[model samples]
Target: MDYLTATKNKKYLMYISQNYSYAILRPLQQEILAQGGEVKWFLEGNEVTSSFLKNNESHLLTIEEVIRWSPDVSFVPGNVIPPFIPGIKVGLFHGFNSGKRNRKGFEDHFNIRGCFDLYCTQGPNTTSRFEQLSKQYKHFAVKETGWPTLDPLFNPDTKSIYTQPDDKRKTLLICSTFSRNLSLAPKLYQTIKTFSEQGKWRILMQFHPKMPNELVTKYQALENENLTFIETDNVLPLLKAADVMLCDTSSILLMFILQRKPVVTFCNQDPGKHLLDVTEPEKVEAAIELALSHPAQLMDDIESFCQQLHPYQDGLSSQRVLAACNELVLTNPKLKPKPLNLIRNLKMRKKLNYWRW
Candidate 1:
């Protein structure tokens, strides 16, 4: 912790993610500054998300601008690790554990490598996954500090998804999945449609970012008043307003637990492998169905079963993340091969028995 704490007075670099995450990081940035650490943000866009920096009373410099500022530690989030910035230390604030059954396609493609002077991760499982992937390629230097992105969800929500009669009220979520290994989407939609038609529930749609806007517009046009379509980049606020979350394998469901809402994962794998290779369509479907068996109440045992689902969601996650970044910077090696071997290797196995955990 000292290694990370040493950044008490250092000027750190941070790669900005979506608008939602910026809010969570703001307080941490304040703490960093209060301790004499100066923070520079590498934001995605200058529109809405960046606007919060002003209220948080923080500052954001574009990547191009940050290059000129040249801080001691560069923290990376979701975007492709930036190109070479001469004369700067790199600290990786990694977002996704790419290369596993849980990782999304865009997330798995471009991973920031060992070039990071320091690497911070979601947790041990993620470290393990990177290690396993390294066995097939390069080594990784990573520390598990949990996800700072979930900082906003640790606290219980002030409200529920809904309190109306469970059978008559519905909370529909527009959702997406990481890997669809079975014929689950259509069937899952059928399940929701059936439930709604029976006056048991309503639908709210939360579309993925990568999805085409026109497609979302078309889906939103579905003639259903009970269905509320989420079009904004920020979905957490909406998730907070919801009661029951319906989606297929979105990491967001983990956040939904903060709302005490139940989750339903939809798989559409008709004998296809979206992840690297290993996938069990039947088991995935069975697990999700069983978890949602409480059609009357969502997430009957979510808090207890969170470990199997997320594995690294401790509430004070941001502080751990800071420690991880600092640890990497202190121990980070230059141009190491197989930077992520151990982690990737352990988690390369399928997520078959996890739900049972």
Candidate 2:
């Protein structure tokens, strides 16, 4: 029997994120708990052990132990053919944001890909793309709720943490993270040095998680009174303080686009490059240097990129996500469709060519 049938909680189950905060996870969880639903967490990664959960009172079970209990919804739930507890409603955290492959290319990864009644989405195009590719996957017409980590970006309290720079220097915030692929680092450093020589911009280097210690120290050693490298979680506050943002598409692009600031995306990753058209290396180098020298050109690039980059600016995407989840598990429930039906629907949608959007 489904655990909800017996325990009688809201029958909504949340898969825990290693990093938790009011940003995205907390609000949905708060909604769940407020409705008298039992909120359970599966502890596996650092997310469960994350200091963020220290004082909060919630029932947490290890991933291995969860097999004995019934799970209603999981973030990626159990890999394949998840232990289907009788009477448990099912849901999943949706999106494959890391890779360039569209919904069609990722079909091979799903063990029981079509089993969920509800699939929460990342944006409108993501919703349209998935529904076009898999008829069984329902993409509700709500705010294409953006990611949760961004919730703090929308918070009012977050604004006060920043201090505007002095009049002498225009701050250039370089947002970077540790990539197993280091090809882009040397070029990026070279580009910054070229700009700094002009003495028009102050460069602040932001390191990504897992950045090499040597790499951090190498840049730190060259510190111009104008150059500073920071590795903490204060990237957003830094973005607010800056005149411009330069990063290799680390979702910080979303933050800048939301703030309506100009941004330059580095397309250095191999498998997951940016989808939009990018300037060539010569064009890129010239643009960066020219923009740095002039700085006013940032407004033009900001406006240009906004056409393709800023679709999910609704800002209240979290609420739409919770509504979609509630509809699937609470208001209306459906069963997983057969893979054959899913593929057949995919084939049918091709004639409509809705995937082109």
Mark the 10 consecutive residues where model 2 has the least summed lDDT: 270-279
Candidate 1 residue spans exceeding 4 A from truth: 1-5, 17-34, 44-53, 56-64, 86-115, 132-140, 157-170, 177-199, 222-225, 240-243, 254-262, 268-305, 308-314, 330-357
lDDT of each: 0.50, 0.49
lDDT of 1 by residue, 213-285 (tens): 5555655565365655565545556666555555544555556654455655444221112211113333443
TM-score of each: 0.64, 0.63
What lDDT tens digits, residue by residue, belong to model 2 across residues 72-113?
A: 544433222233322233333422233333346553223234
Runs off by more than 4 Å, candidate 2: 1-43, 46-49, 52-54, 57-61, 64-117, 136-143, 160-162, 165-168, 177-183, 193-199, 210-213, 220-225, 233-235, 267-286, 289-314, 337-357
lDDT of 1: 0.50
TM-score of 1: 0.64
